[model samples]
Target chain A: MRLRLTPRDTSFFDLLADSASHLVVGANLLSELLGADRAGRKAIAKKLADVEHAADEATHSIMRRLNSTFVTPFDRDDISGLASALDDCMDFMEEAGDLIVLYKLDELPARVSDQIQVLQRCAELTADAMPHLRSMGDLTDYWVEVNSLENQADKIHRKLLAQMFDEIADPIQLMKLKEVVETLELAADAFETVANMVETIALKES
Target chain B: MRLRLTPRDTSFFDLLADSASHLVVGANLLSELLGADRAGRKAIAKKLADVEHAADEATHSIMRRLNSTFVTPFDRDDISGLASALDDCMDFMEEAGDLIVLYKLDELPARVSDQIQVLQRCAELTADAMPHLRSMGDLTDYWVEVNSLENQADKIHRKLLAQMFDEIADPIQLMKLKEVVETLELAADAFETVANMVETIALKES
Candidate 1:
């Protein structure tokens, strides 16, 4: 682990991490809805909203932690970045849910499914990376891998955009798809941010 | 007065701040070219190009500082947000340069000028706000003032958007105007992000 804090410092990372996973949970629900029947879609959408709302509360908790605690487990900057990055991941998930509702996407998008898989993978990486921050010999490998996932997200994002523009001749559809793809990529970017902060922390710990 | 850093911290804050103000200089120069005479307009456009280039350099420098530094004068997240916000402001100025070049808008736009003025004011406030972040006693007043500036920027953004939609008759023209105005407003939102980060830091510092 890169960071070697006593158990007291672990809670902050744990809470931040729980929030990060919750965002992934929200994304999972959203992805499931994409594949579900109409009734199931509606139900899953509602569930996704609930998850997103909970994620908001989680963000508040982290923010409160950020304010009250002075001797943070790690660098104060890393804590702030981690918290904001987690919140941003959730924000993107919520945006994806709302966008699904707004666009009334009748079926799951293949690209969206692909993107969600990437999001989930990164979430797992984030969860895994936290513990290693405590005194890991080297996390550059994890950092690099996480960056790769972000790039994969970017790949799908660009492909989806191109598909949207190429396959859908409608300007309005193009715009809508552009916004959706952008939001998805943004979610991945948040993960990349977490990765970047993690790398910084790793450097310090090393 | 609100921020409470040692004198050493102030020097770094000053550097980050100088980067921000330098972009405003670009904006101010760009504003002048808006209503310039034929040769004067061309001269100002070139000058705007130089300012835009300088902003790019500033952004690079800020990010480099982020990469190398361990103990920041301010919170890491605040630095990140401020760096982005500062770049965003410069981006707004760059877009103005693009608009000037694209539209052949020789005369300074009242609306554009208004937006630029607001932006300069916002940048100045942001510069002022950072110094206050380490001190908490006067934090409330500064935050209120920053919020007020943000509000003013929002109002202006709305009015500019309304003007774009209503007065611009041609579709192509509308597209150009909309992009410019929206970019400017987005820049304002970026500044607001900085303010919000500052408030968060203040809450922690206090």
Candidate 2:
């Protein structure tokens, strides 16, 4: 057997970590936009656009690296899945924020606060865990925490949906709130996917 | 530079094609579920579950192959992504069907028929494209058609959403219909993701 000497470019991990960090920024902004007034929310949304753009650039960097590199530190599929899932989380965050601004939703259900908080926790944990991907050590806790947070978010989602359908009178307002909440729920789901990807990689490597 | 002699396992393509075919099955059943009455829809949803289970098995086969194979016909990312995206399509399809049954929705918007038609077209195109993936010939048109179908589905989704929020008076009923439509929209989005993945692979390989 011929000995292979191609060096694994580890920069991809850094880029992924950078992308996860951007998710934290976007998720926090989403939480802030939930309570902001019209003008404030618009400004926050603009800031969110910047965050999403940064995450996009990070994702593009990852794709470029994947295309050029011959050998990766881990399977390319895991890397691609992680990058895309992180990008998705940011996209949903941006969508939720933009919906609030576009729909002019002045008031939201009370449980939205709890849901956003769960998202913020998921983001922070994602950012924290990404760096450890290089070592593939002590990462189970990250995914477990994210999974727990996602479950918490799901409970909030179900309760909020039930309350909206049962209590709201105006269909238009109900639809608007539902869209906003559902987007957040999707973002949470995406974060869970990312966590699952991380778990898969860790299991394979360990 | 040293030449390598390990044979690339190509069965991944077959498994992915199998998964895509299952998506076609699930999507067709979804179209049927929309037109189905109370008892008939439950039966259809059960059938969708079986399709989803088959797709899940196909996905697991891909994962097992990825774990054991040293060399793949294409980038492992594309293989795994294609499999997962196809699985997601079935999942969302199943979710939409189950929502219809669980929510006991008697009637959906007329525009939903158009959405289901677009999904059927996408499914057929995806199934046709999977066989060509091995040769990487004449696949561009497949992704192109899937993209066009997705765009058509988007238009229908927007119209349905607008109608739901504008016309529906009962919040509970509106809520059920919205969930059903949103799940179908998500399945359509998953199809677009699959198309994009195929395009990515085609661009890289050819």
Share of native C-alpha contacts between chains A and B (below 8 angstroms) recovered by candidate 2:
0.17
Interface RMSD, one decimal, each candidate: 5.4, 4.3
DockQ of 2: 0.17
True contacts kept of each: 0.08, 0.17
Tens-place lDDT digits, model 2, residues A77-150: 67877898999899888978887877778888889888889999999999999999999998989999999989
Q: Per-residue alpha-carbon lDDT of model 1 for A84-200, expressed as tens digits?
A: 777778767666766665555565458988988888888777777766666654568778988999999999988887777778865544544565678789989988988898887
Q: After superposition, how far is residue B22 of candidate 1 from its true place, in Å?
A: 10
Q: Candidate 1 chain A: minimum summed lDDT over ten consecutive residues — where?
A: A170-179
* Model 2 stretches with alpha carbons more than 4 Å out: A1-4, A39-57, A98-103, A137-141, A151-179, B1-121, B137-160, B170-180, B196-206
- Candidate 2, position A28, lDDT: 91
